[model samples]
Structure formats: C-alpha cells, structure tokens
Target chain A: LAKTTQPISMDSYEGQEVNITCSHNNIATNDYITWYQQFPSQGPRFIIQGYKTKVTNEVASLFIPADRKSSTLSLPRVSLSDTAVYYCLVGAPHRYGGATNKLIFGTGTLLAVQP
Target chain B: DAGVTQSPTHLIKTRGQQVTLRCSPKSGHDTVSWYQQALGQGPQFIFQYYEEEERQRGNFPDRFSGHQFPNYSSELNVNALLLGDSALYLCASSASWSGPQHFGDGTRLSIL
Candidate 1:
C-alpha cells in the first residue's frame, strides 16, 4: 500500500468549491486512487475513485496528474452537510485469491463548510 | 435493501475480559473486513474474511481474531482485552475482494 498524505484540515463556505489533494510519492503501477467521506460517528463513505486523468461522479471529481504521485478530490457547491473528514487511499482493486483489499487511511482532511 | 448491519451498537467491557461483535454483510456481499478506529484517528485494518476463511490480516496481533460464516455474516472476538482496545469497531462488506465496500455504523467498544 502506498502511503498517502493529506492536509490536516480545510475550511470552505457553502456554495463554494473545495478541493483536497493527497500526495503519494511511492505510488505503484497497479495502484488506484480512491477517496472516502466520513461524518462524525459514522463509517467512511466512498466518494469517487480514479486511476489516471479525471473521473467525475455526481458527488465529486478526481483529478490525477500524469505522474500519478498526487490526486485531488473536488466537491462543487459544498453545503453545510458536507462537513466531514475526507480520506485518500492508494491501492489496487481486489482480485480473487489476491491480497486482502484493506484500505489504509490517513488522518484525513477535515473539511469544514461554513455558512 | 439493508446495508451492512452490526449488533450491540455500543459495548463496555473491563480489561482482561472478552467481547464478541457480530456483523451481517450487505445483501449480495460475500466478503467482510474488520477495522479498528481510535478516537480522532483513521480506521486501521484488522483482517479480512472471504469464503468462510481468513484471507488476510493487518499488523494486528492474534488477540484479534475473526470468523466468517457460510452465510457471509462475521464475528470479531477479542480476548484479554486492554484499555488500548477501546475504539469503534467497523465492519465493511464488499461484493468482491476488489469492489467498493459498504460499511456498517460499527460497534463502539469501551474497555474500562
């Protein structure tokens, strides 16, 4: 598993766009970048994932540079409900009979959305 | 339509005591993994279970053990618990080893 580093915290206002970047200098060829959102007292929820370039879903967009050393998760029109810790994970998707697909989480970026 | 479910949403045990936590995977999910999350920290992988066998585990010690049933339900057993073991235990279920995982609310264990 590639070690991921993210900001300890970030602040944004409602209706604004928030981007959290994660750095993984040792990313491998088969590594995939996945992001998760976690609220207080709840398990982290999958937000988006990408291997390279850009992948956008209804909730967020992931941008990966050609070097693949770092990735960014962009949340548009943020709301108060979006306040949570965002995690960046680097690993390969699970293959049958393969190593366990356990996600290694960092301290995560605590995104605080203001009014 | 039910997501992953865990029993005894919260538990309290004394040091050296044993505790058992149960989890029922999300519908159609065959793999279950357990994680330990300490306060103000990220979740740490404990182990993963597939096909009713222990597939892989993290750096946790044997004090942390688990079992996966044929029905895909799972249990985490902790013996000779220490105060350090107090944390939220999360159970995640995935359709395949590599697919997106769904998590349950978790069982909050407090070792007093």
Candidate 2:
C-alpha cells in the first residue's frame, strides 16, 4: 500500500469550483486513487476514483498525471451542502484469495464551502 | 435500496469492559469491513470478514475481534477496553472484494 498526503483544509464559496490534491509518491502499479467525502456525523461517501489520466462522474472529476504520483479531485459549482471532509486514499482494488482491499485514510482535506 | 446499517448509534463504557457493535451490510453485499475513527482523524482499518471467515486484518490487536454470519452481517467485539478505545466505529460493505465499499454512519463508543 502507498501512503498519501493531502491538504488539511480548503475554502470555497458557493457556486465556485474546488480542487483538492493528494500526493502518493510511492504508489504501486496496481494502486488506484480514490476520493471520499464525509459529512459531520456521517460516514464517508465515495466521490471519485481513477488510475491514470482522467475520470468523471456526476459528482466530481479525478485527474491523474502520467507519473501517477498525485491526483486532484475537482468539485464544480460547489454549494453549502458540499461542505465536508474529503479524504484521499491509495490502494489496490483487491488482493488474491478473495481478500478484501482495506482502505487507508489520511487526516483529509476539510472543504468549508461558505455561502 | 437500503445501504449499510449499524446498531447502537451511541454507547458508553468503562475500562476493562467489553463491547460489541453490530453491522448489517447493504443488500446483495457479501463482504464487510470495520474501521475506527478518532475525533478529527481519518478512519483506520480494523479487519474485514467474508464468507464467515476472517480474510484480512489491520494493525489492530487480538482484543479486537469480529464474526461474520452466513447472511453477511457482522459483529465487532472489543474486550478489556481502554479509554483510548473510544472512537466512532464504522462498518462498510461491498458486493465483492473488488467492488466499492459503502459505509454506515458508525457507532460512537465513549470509554470513560
């Protein structure tokens, strides 16, 4: 498993775009970048995931570079409801023998969306 | 469809006591994983159970044990608890080991 680093906090205004970056210098070939959003008193919700290049979903977009050392989660036109802690994790999807892939989480980036 | 569900949203315990937390995986899910989250910190993996067997474990101690039933529901048992054990325990479920995990709100355990 590779260790990840992310910003402790970020600020955004309503209807603005917010980008949170995470760095994983020792990412393995099988590893993928996953971003999760957690609201207060709630479990983390899956946001976006990517291996290399770019991947987009209805909620967010993930951009990975050729090096795969880092990833950026982009949230477009943010709202107050989007204020939450965003976590960046790096891990393989699964191991052999049907063993599950355990998620490794960092302190995460606290996105404070102000009205 | 209902997502992952956990039991006893809040609990209080003292030193050397034992506590059990329950979790029901999402519909059609077979794999369950447990995590512990301290205040202002990221969740840490405890272990994962599949097919009524312990498949993977984290850096947790033997005091932290788990059981998975045939229905894919799971229980997390912690014995001889310490104040440091106080945290929000989260349960996540996935259709398979390769699928994305869905998490429950977690059971908040406070150790005095």
Candidate 3:
C-alpha cells in the first residue's frame, strides 16, 4: 500500500476554486490516484480518478504529473455544501490487474467552504 | 439501484461484551470491506471478504473479525471489546474488486 500526504485543512469562499494536492512518493506503476469526499455522518463519495495527466468529471478534476509522485484535486465554484474532507488515495492494483480492496485513508484535507 | 446499507445506525456496548454489525452490499457487488473511523481521524481498514472467505486484512487485531455470506451480505463481530473500540464502523462494497467502492452510512458504536 502506498502512503499519501495531503493538507490537513483548507479554507475557501463561495465561487472560488480549491485545489488540494497529495504527495505519494512511493506510488507504484500500476497505482491509480483517486479522490473521495466525505461529509459529516456520511460515507466518502468518489470525486475523480486518474492514472496520469488530467481527468475531469462533472464534479472535479484530477491533475497528475508525469512523475506520478504527486497529484492535485481541483474543485470549481466552491459552495457551503462542498465543505467536507477530501481524501486522496493511491490505488494499489492486485497482481491479477484489479485494484486492491484495501483503501488507506489519511487525515485528509478538510475543505471548509464559506458562504 | 441501492448502495451499500448497514444496520443499526447506532449501538451501545460495554467493555468485554461482543457486538455484531451487519452490511448489505450494493447490487452486483461481490466484495465487502470494513473500516473503523475514530473521531477527528481518517478511517482505518479492518478487513475485506470475497467469495465467502476472508481475503485481506489490515492491522486490526483478531478481536475484530468479519464474515461474508453467499449473498454478499456481511457481518462484523468484535469480541471482548474495549473502551477504545468506540468508533464508527463503515462497510464498503465493490464490484469484483474493481472500481470505486460504495459505502454505507456506518454504524456508530459507543463503548462505555
């Protein structure tokens, strides 16, 4: 399992963009960087995932450099509802090609979106 | 389609007692994983079950054990629990060990 480091907390106002970076120096070649969001009393929700370069979804975008050692999650137009903890995980692929079931979560970046 | 569902949203237990938490995976999901989250901390993996067998485990002790049934529903059992065992237990299910795992709201266990 690859360990990830991210900011403990970030503050943003409504309509602003937020970018949280995660460092995973030991990320493996088969690993995929994934991000999740968690609101209080709820499970973490999948935001975006990418293997390299950039991937964008309806909610957020993931930017990974060629080094693969670090990645950033970019959220546009922050709102109070977006206030939650964001987790960055490096998915360790199983020898059989499927990703590992074990998801290691760190403290995560708690993004407080102010109105 | 329904996502992962866990039973007994809240539970109260005492030290040395045993507790059981249940989870039903999302439709078509064949693997279930358990995690424990302490207040102000990220969730820690407990173990995962596939094919009605314990496949992978984390750093959790033997006291924290789980069982997956043929239907893919699972049960987590903790024996001789301690005060430190008080936390939120979350269950996540994935499809064939691929893609993102859907999670339940988690069972809040308060050990007194």
Candidate 4:
C-alpha cells in the first residue's frame, strides 16, 4: 500500500475553489489515486479517481502529474454543505498478487467551507 | 436499492465479554469488509470476506474475527474484549474485490 500525506485542515469560503493535495512518493505504476468525502456520521463518498493526468466528474476533479508521486483534488464553487473531511488514497484496483484493495484512510483534511 | 445495513447502532460491553455485530451488504455486493474507527482518527481495516471466506486481514489480534454467510451478510465477533476496544465498528460492502464500497452507519461499541 502506498501511504499518502495530506493537509490536516483547510478553510475556504463558499463559492470559492478548494484544492487539497496528497503526496504518495512510493506510488506504484498500477496504483490509482482516489479521493473521498466524508460528512459527519456518514460513510466516505467517492469523489473522484484517476490513474494519471486529469479526470473530471460531476462532483470534483483529480489532477495527477506525470511523476505520479502526488495528486490534487479540486472542488469548484464550494458550499457550506461541502464542509467535510476529505481522504486521499493510493492503491491498485486489483485484489490478487498484492495487498488487498482495502482503503487506508488518513487523518484527512477537515475542509470548513464558510458561507 | 437499500445500502449496507448494520445492527445495534450502539452497544455497551464490559471487559472480558464477547460481542457480535451484524452487517447486511448492499443489494448486489458480495464482499464485506470491517473497520474500526476511534474518535478523531481514521478507520482501520479489520478484515475482508469474499465468497464466504476470509480473504484478507489487517494487524488486529485473533480476538477479532469475522464470518461471512452465503447470503453475503457478515458478522464481526470480538472475544475477551478490552476497554480499548471501544470504538465505532464499520461494515463496508463492495461488488468485487477492488471496486468502490458502500458503508453502513456503523455500530458504536463502548467498552466499560
């Protein structure tokens, strides 16, 4: 499993864009960078996932540089409801021949979206 | 469809007692995984079951064990529990081994 490092907390105002970066220096070639959003008392929701370059979804966007050692999760036009913890995970999508695809969440960055 | 569901939203147990928590996976999911979350910390993986067998596990002790039934529902059993075992036990269900997983509300276990 590739250990990830991210900010512990971040603060932003509503309607502003927020970007949280994660560092996974030991990322493997088969690993994918995934981000999840977790609200209080709720399970972590999948936000975006990408293997390389950029991938955009209805909720968020993931940008991975060519180096693959780090990635960033970008949330556009944030709202107070978007205030939650965001987790960054780096692992492969396969289950066999390596560690299980179990997600190991970090402390997460507590994003406080002010209104 | 109904998402993953766990039983006994909250529980209180004493040290040295055994406790069982139940989880019903999502409608189409066949794999179940358990995790333990302490306050202010991220969840730690306990184990995962696929095809009604224990597939993978974390560093947790043998006192923590799990079973997955044919229906894909699962049970997490803790024997001779200690006070430090108090935490939120989470159950997640996935369609395959590496796909996205849906989680239940989790059972908050408080050991006294």
Sequence-dependent TM-score of model 1? 0.96
- Model 3, B2-59: lDDT tens digits are 9999998999999999999999999988888999999988999999888888888999
Q: Write the per-residue lDDT of candidate 4 for residues A1-115, one digit (tens) a residue.
A: 9999999999999999999999999999889888888887666777888999999989898999999999999999999999999999888766764224788989999999998
Q: Predict model 3's lDDT versus the native.
A: 0.90
Return the TM-score for candidate 2, rounded to 2 decimals: 0.96
Here the TM-score of candidate 1's chain B is 0.97
Give me the runs in candidate 1 sitting further than 4 Å from their true place.
Answer: A96-100
Candidate 2 lDDT over residue span A19-84, tens digit each = 899999999998989999999778999888789999999999999999999999999999999999
> What is the interface RMSD, in angstroms, for predicted model 2?
1.4
Give i-RMS (Å) per prediction: 2.0, 1.4, 2.1, 2.8
Task: List the candidate 3 regions with Cα displacement exceeding 4 Å.
Answer: A93-99
Which is the winner by TM-score between candidate 1 and candidate 4?
A: 1
DockQ for all candidate structures vs. native? 0.65, 0.72, 0.59, 0.52
**Best model number under DockQ:** 2
Instruction: Compose the digit string of candidate 3's lDDT tens values, residues A12-90.
Output: 9999999999999999888899898998888888888899999999999899999999999999998899999999999
Tell me the tens digit of each residue's lDDT in model 1 across A5-54. 99999999999999999999999998899899999889888888899999
Candidate 1: residue B37 Cα off by (Å) = 0.3
| Sort by DockQ, top down from the best | 2, 1, 3, 4
- TM-score per prediction, in order, is 0.96, 0.96, 0.96, 0.94
Please state the Cα-based DockQ of model 1 relative to the true two-chain complex. Answer: 0.65
Name the 10 consecutive residues with the lowest summed lDDT in model 3 chain A. Answer: A92-101
Q: Which of the two, 2 or 3, has more DockQ?
A: 2
